[model samples]
Target: MKNLVVAAAVATALSMASMGAHAASPNELAQIREQLEALMQRVDKLEKENTELKTENENLKAADEKLQANDDYLKSEARGLRKEAAQQAVEVGKVKGADWAGKVAITGDMRYRYEMISDETLSSSGVQTADRYRDRIRARLNATVKATDDITVGIGFATAEGNDPRSSNQSLTSVFSRKSLDLDLAYFDWKFATWGNLIGGKMKQPFLKPGQSLFWDNDINPEGLAVNFQGGMFFGTAYNYWLTETSGPETNLTADTMLHGLQIGTRLPIGQNSLMLAAHYYDLSAGQGRAPFYNGSNGNTTDTVVLNGTSTAVLRYDYEVVNLSAEFNTMFGQTPFQVWADVAQNQDADDLDTAWSAGVLLGKASNYRTWELGAFYQVIEKDALFAQLIDSDFANGVSDSEGWVVRAGYAPVRNWLINATYFLNKRNIDAPTSAGQLDIDYDRLQVDFNVKF
Candidate 1:
């Protein structure tokens, strides 16, 4: 615009000069020069304004680019947040759909064992049998459900060769025949009071095994009703179980066999150690003179009786057993130590009715890299405990036996164990066993690999 104005002014001046030729005067020339100066000033002002506008436009463009970058970053962040939210929602839905899964618990264990049995038996023919070697396996699975706030239900299955209450081991034999899976546990426990519980069905023993006592075999699951109570340092258990049922009988004496048991104990703390003392009473009056045997008499004294038009051997005396047990636990530096003893007597038996066991354990085999060693000596006289209920591995599961049990265990990792148990025992210590009248040596070795989950 300045160039156009200047050109037009110059053209006009030239035109006047041409028209006025010699008539042109100095005044006209002065007027033209003044107009040229004004035009130059206007051009300088317009140039300054145009430079300022260009600077403002450049600043606006830079701001717009920065805003676009920030907007892209925000959009990317929103996408990530949406994905995370979706993942969380899926997890929440899964938990809501299986809410009852929290109330149920499943646990199981398996044991594989290599066993060697050596028995020294005396026979009239003077013949000796060879020692036996076998492999065995035991697997158990249990489920516990919290049915209600105060009620719990448990069910379990275990490998077994037969319905023998004293053992759950299935020997590996029979040309790969299928093994049996039997019901090992089925019970309901109700917390009827703050310090008491009512348990029924085929259930675990309610009595405490202070010394890991073998007076009652660990595998025995008694079908009965049990009540357990504990308050402060006092605890007690009572149970009644049926041994045999007799119905529609016509005889001189007829009744169902039953066993009743009660145990009471107390725990006393002494410094960092604790001591426990307990007394147990078991009565099987109804089983007297009854042929209520599962495996056999197992060296228990018996009387011959006629039943169902056949001759049979029945229990000779009632079993009214009284047991006293004590256990002391203490810590020696970082290792644990325990000492325990048990004495039992069947009051109804006239003679040979005493049983006793004493043991000491060093350390404990729990968690990884832990080990334990224990040894115990036991003497079970002929009429002491009910023979069918004793540990099957001890002295060939017979009464009138005296033995030593040495056990060692180690855990290489969590929930896995290696164990060895040796039994050096003599059967028929005082009286003849059902197998023979002569005393015999019974030795057994068991090595086990155990795993639990």
Candidate 2:
């Protein structure tokens, strides 16, 4: 049988291969539903991009908490503006008070002096010889306080009385008390802008030139320490008091001591004119034992001799004194002129004599008149008054003495002053009873009325 005819042609070739796989199974189920609709449109676009990245991470965490609350409100407004600038710096240091408690200062001067003295020579202790009219009064008051800024403290009061031209002319109607308003000048001043001033208690002592009265006696006032300086060349130094002691010897042997002095100065200027130089030193002793002319009497004491039984007599006195001066002041137009010269030396007992003077002054004050013209010449050598009258025999061996003065002044109003003066004196004594020599001369005329404030 040919194997049943090839099994019927293999069952008709498996029925046409199952009809071509059922026609490709409806196009593979329509291409698997178009690939599941393109995978659900890409999972709905990845879930809308995960909800837009969670709303941009909650908007960057709310802008980082609003920038940390604006940095804590700018650090609490800068700590309340630094606590109101530290309470306005403590109320401006409590209204600025005490830096030395309100300082106060006052100064004063009042003067009324009139003097007239002429040819005096009459004194057997019953002294009287004059043609005079005198009245003097001076006043001063000053005060200050400023405990800082280079420190300062001051106080002063002064008063003066006059008429002591060797006492006579009714004793000048009594007012004898020159400078007793106490404390002429109490001081403490120090300023140094390159070493210029320094002062300590009881002032006024700078060799000479404070209106020059020819060395000493401008109503004598002196105490301690003083120094002054200026660069264009001017300097000073002082420590004063040549002698001071009231009453002793017999009222129980009382004693006091003080006699130490020194002063130095310098000043220089040429073209316009200015020149001054000075030096002075003194150290005197023997502070006690008053009256009886220091008991060493030698007027022959009516003859008394006792050798070893003790009846002694040995007289010689003088401690020390030295002075030197030079001056020249100038101004030609407004009128201010001065020329002065001086020399004084008394080395005491050892006898080294010198006393000299030369002067010239011309002045002017405007708005009417305040004139002046002066001339002077003086020489007292012969052992400088023989050691200043060594225990007096009415002052021995006094050889030469000369003087000259002429003055004129007028002020009209402001403090009132008027004056006129003329004086000339000469002496050459040596007649204890005429061995032949005693020429005395004098001529004087004066009138003055002054009031100053």
Candidate 3:
């Protein structure tokens, strides 16, 4: 463009020179030439300024594109960072919830009872015992923690009158005296396999007691190591319990007493119904000729032994007991029904070594507004079982008794129930009394209000 402008100017100048060569003087021509030079110089300066402006414009476009690219990148990174932070917050909340709330559990029950007992026991002096009535309360609290996926730890506390392993009832006597509270359960359970558990410490009974059977009292928590297993329809338990720890030598079987037990059972399906049968065998080593009595003998046959110049009644025979139990479960028109039987024998005792019980139950007292009814007849001979470990409420916790127990329960609300139990029993059925042969009538009634959480 600059060259074209200069050429056009030169052509115009030549045309003027050619047109005015005869009519123009030297000064005019010289002035025209000088003016043409000045215009060319001005055109060159303007062209240089236009080139600089184009270069500046290209640089500005490049800088704008670079800034826009940077803005887009920053926006995308910020969005990703915000999403990652939200996910981290959610993960933190889940961990907090599991640690504080999901892994720990607290559970317990409280029961208040009104009990009445009528005894017709006759003493050697021909005196009859009096009837008694009492109000009792039991409160228990337990806490469990899932320390790991396969490990659990539990601890519990309960109210009791004394250190009686069979009962945890605190009588409402002593004019509002401060009652005793003891450690009821403290144990750790480790799931060593998919089908078994290993538990140690003073723990709940690992053996199954079918159909509310009194062969093993519900409140008895044995101390030692227990192994429990279940595979398909088969289940079993083995336990090594410390009964007494004497400082005497191990070879002296008359001092230290230990109880070892094993139970094996199976559940078989039979046409929409199920039947469970189990056999449990336990032996009290070194119990014979030894006084391993807690709260006295409870009517087990005993022989007097002199210890430290004091005569004490020791167990007459070793207790090697085998228990067989069976239960048939069916549904009776939407109500659960069960028929069960339990029998036990002491192989070491030659006389009065058998006990048996049979029962039928209809319905279950579970959930709100549910009810149940059950009855069982049992006869425990003089040496049938270890009396200290049997049911404390049956015939006043004595052997040599035959009785019928009728139980009814109703749940008025969730986790709360009222129960009524009646015992019609005769004691001293086979054992000889202080007098002659005798069968004394004994009766008991208990009404309980229980709640759990």
Candidate 4:
């Protein structure tokens, strides 16, 4: 570079010297030398500035590459944070779902009934017995909660005596004393699959009884575990009910009364009609004489049969029951009708071990002003079923009873119903008392006003 600049300056000075060789003096030559020197100085200054600019550009490129790498890293971190946030949201939703109280549903019903009862003994026996009249009320409240998609829990409160499982009606007696309100039901139903459910605690009866309430009452909620299954039109249930839980007198005595039950039923459609049929077998374990059937309730007590008139000798008793129920539902024009029957037998009782009931119902009530009429003839023999577990209003909650129940119901509005029922019944069917061939005609009249949510 220095050699090239020196050559250019020498060539320019020679040209100028040749042109002014005969006319120019020493001062002109000196001026040319000074011009050449100034040009060389300017070129050297530009070289230093260009080198500095190139160095600055290289530094800026390195900084730009570092910035690009940082940008990629920041973008990856942002994506990870967004994914983590979504996961946390799902976890929060699951946590909120387990808060059962906020998600529970509440429902209840109230029933007011006026009842009149008369027994033939009250009429005869040279005794003037005024008809018994009573007013009763039943109030029930229930709440259900969802624990998950497949699990649910329910709680219920009802008005009833703590000991009697068959009655929820609080009689209007005791000079306006506070009626007993008890825990009616508390259960968890776990549905692990589409076809089955496992339920625990005190719950609604898991067995299927048809339109006729023969063996089991409507108010009996069994405690312990129950399992149910369904496939197509077929359904079945198995239950292990805890009848008694007690600390017995001895260590080896398992005096607890248990009821093991199995039931199977089917519902099928045939042309324009539907048929429902079910059978149940309940094996009463340890219920022989260990358990009290609603203490002081004679209709459900077991008599101690002394062997050879010896009071010390007693017979072992077991009430094993098997029952079948069937119903036929068909439409007469737009009106619905049903014919149903139920039969039960106790394999252990000495006599009158079989009982049966048949009923006919016309015009099912579903809407406002819709009316229905039904009549049933039921004969519940002694020891056929635990009388305490039978319908409380039928035969006055006594076995060895045969009765005809006629009922009429009307709906004034949705979820509100008015009904009248007449029970023309007979008691002492098997003559448990000393009165042989003696039967008392006991009749009951009931009028109910009910509302439900």
Candidate 5:
């Protein structure tokens, strides 16, 4: 019985121990599960924080890129501005350094001419010579200084050198002296709005009209003041001079001393033609003693007049010259045709002292060639004073004078010109010894080559 009771107690103790082990195992498992749940929540919160940090980094990167782009744009604009400024500075420098401004100009002309003459007269002694050829060169230089808008000073120098056919043995010298420097235009031209201009200084005489004529050549320039005005329809002038004298002669006679003249005229345009009318007056008085007779008179007592007199010789010379000129020119059409007529009356002289000319010109001027055919009829009445002064040459001593001219030219390029011309002159002079007049004629042919710059 004791053995059986011990066995039962052992069995009970073993069962209790097993029960306790089972309960502890279950509690440990629950605690483990709870710790695992907390760990999972912590990991989820960390993942959320990581995602927020990644978004913030992306935004910062985008902002940095934008700022870089803005910086690049600003730099580009700055570079362009700097380049433009530099270019402007260079242009300004060029303008400032340019010395050939508004105050400088240069002009000159050179002409080489060959002339052949028939019926040439000897000037030393009254005789007629054979036909001859001559060569001549003429040059002119002009310069100006513009001190102001209204004031200008200028100088002109001209020279001519030639071989005289009459004196071929003599050395070639200056036909006109080399030291001939003239005050071309030393004047102050006042600008006016209503009136044209008022010029004062050594200026051109107002009596003669400007034309390209070699016949009536007058190498005379005077010092005077002039007023020029031109409006819509009216154009006229009143010019008075204190003196009129020849350039080479020094004299105090009425012809060389205080002389006064006036010119009044206007232009009327009819279609493409123009008509000019002018009237002139000159009063001459011998201010000093009578002019000396250096040459002996040829037994002509009636021709001699004593100039030494106290009497106020009211020698009134009046002239009325009319110009009827017309031009028909075109750029591409049938060239040009021009006609002119000049008539003058020296009323103070005899009835035969009248001078008149009528001319007609037809030309075709183009880039390659220019040709003209012209004919003129000139009549100069007999004048005794003119005959005496020119030493009985046909040019001065004339009952009637007539001439005809023809010209042809070619210009292959700018600055160069080639031309040829022919002239025929005829004169009839009244011979005092004979009951009739003497007839004389002359012919000239000229070729010219000219360069201008």
Candidate 6:
């Protein structure tokens, strides 16, 4: 625009200075003035265009700066997120390292029972003893801690008294007094091999006990070391337990009464059915004569019936038992059914040394509102098995007895069971008590409600 104005001014000055050249024409001056007006208008339009270009350049510069700032902010935020994620990963690893509680588990069960026992016999004067009734309960709590991948330690407590290897029930007495809890089970099980296990302390029966416990009570927890093996269809077990704890009374050095037992079993398939057969042998000959047999409960039984005191012994018998058991299970009309037999013999007894039991269980009470029924007839002769270790409720725990037990169980819901068992038996089939000899009928009724978790 400046150059245009300069050129216009020089032209006007020359036109005026040379006006005499066109002195004959006045129209030239008017035309020159009109040309000057058009130059001024062009200069105004060029100034407006320059101002708009400057404004556009400023806007582009501001936009470029805003974009750069946004990029820097995004980079900073990504760095913060990476740091947070790394911190979270470290915390997760620490939590995994401190997982002691996760490696342990807890389990337990509770059972309440009501028992009615009756002894139908006449005294020497021909009068019967009063019927007995009691309310009993058994409770257990156990914990299993995994110290290593293949080694587990367990400890448990139960409502029990003394060292009654035969029972864990404490009768409700002393007017609902608080019950006592004893160290019922404690053991360490090491599975060092794929087919064998070593367990110590007072633990569960390592040997496979048949449905009918002829020689050992189902509730007995042996205090000893046991090793069990299983390979394919064959399985075996061997263990030794302290039968009597002696503080010393007998002079003989070989009077330690220990129980050494062995068991071996096999399972064979017959068509679609299977049969499990087992043979068991236990030597208790060391506990006879000199050694004392305690009532597992109070350490007393008929054989060791101390005449009003603990010194004199009336009966003593040597026992070495060999028992055989078999179980056959099959489907009976869409439900499982089982038949089992347990027979044990004391090889050292002269007479009444055989004990046998056979039973059948129909259906299964494994689900909600399910039911099952079972019945068994057992004959345990005198001196067959240790009288102290036998079932306490059968034939009043007296040997030389034969009886039948009928039982039924129902499950109203999962994990809950209700059962009823009735034992009809006759006691003292051979030897006569001091009150002469009477084949006394013994009856017991038990109703139990049990829950497990």
What is the alpha-carbon lDDT for the whole of candidate 2? 0.54
lDDT string, candidate 3, 316-413, tens digits: 99999999999999999899999999999999999999999999999999888999999999999999999989898989889999999999999999
lDDT of 6 by residue, 355-374 (tens): 99999888787689899999
Instruction: Give the top-scoring candidate (TM-score).
Output: 3
Better of 1 and 5 by TM-score: 1
Count of backbone clashes, every candidate in sequence: 0, 0, 0, 0, 0, 3
Q: Look at candidate 6 and tell me the lDDT of residue 411.
A: 93
Clashing pairs in 3: none
Best-first order by lDDT: 3, 1, 4, 6, 2, 5
TM-score of each model, paired residue for residue: 0.79, 0.24, 0.80, 0.75, 0.57, 0.75
| Candidate 4, 1-453: lDDT as tens digits | 766987988997898789879988889888888998888888788888889999999999999999999999999999999999999999988887766556788999999999999976543245534679999999999989887889889999999966578889988998999988899999999998899999999999877787856567899899999999999999999999887686745643357778898999999999999999998898888767443466544354455644234532122357788899999999999889999999999888777778899999998665888999999999888777766578877877778889899999999888899999999998887664443435777899999999999
For all candidates in order, the CA lDDT equals 0.90, 0.54, 0.92, 0.83, 0.51, 0.80
Root-mean-square deviation of each candidate, in angstroms?
A: 11.1, 23.4, 7.0, 7.7, 15.2, 10.8
Q: How far in Å is the alpha carbon of 167 misplaced in model 1?
A: 0.6
After superposing candidate 6, which stretches have Cα over 4 Å from the reference?
1-99, 121-127, 161-163, 248-250, 296-310
Q: Model 5, stretches more than 4 Å misplaced?
A: 1-100, 120-127, 160-188, 192-194, 204-220, 241-259, 264-269, 272-332, 364-368, 383-400, 431-437
The C-alpha stretches of model 1 lying farther than 4 A from their native spots are 1-93, 250-253, 433-436
Collision count of model 4 = 0
User: What does candidate 1's lDDT look like per residue over 17-92, in tens digits?
Assistant: 8988788788878888998888878887898899899999999899899999999999999999899999989988
- Give me the displacement of residue 261 in model 2, in angstroms: 2.5
Worst 10 residues of 4 by lDDT: 307-316
Instruction: Tell me model 1's lDDT, rounded to 2 decimals.
Output: 0.90
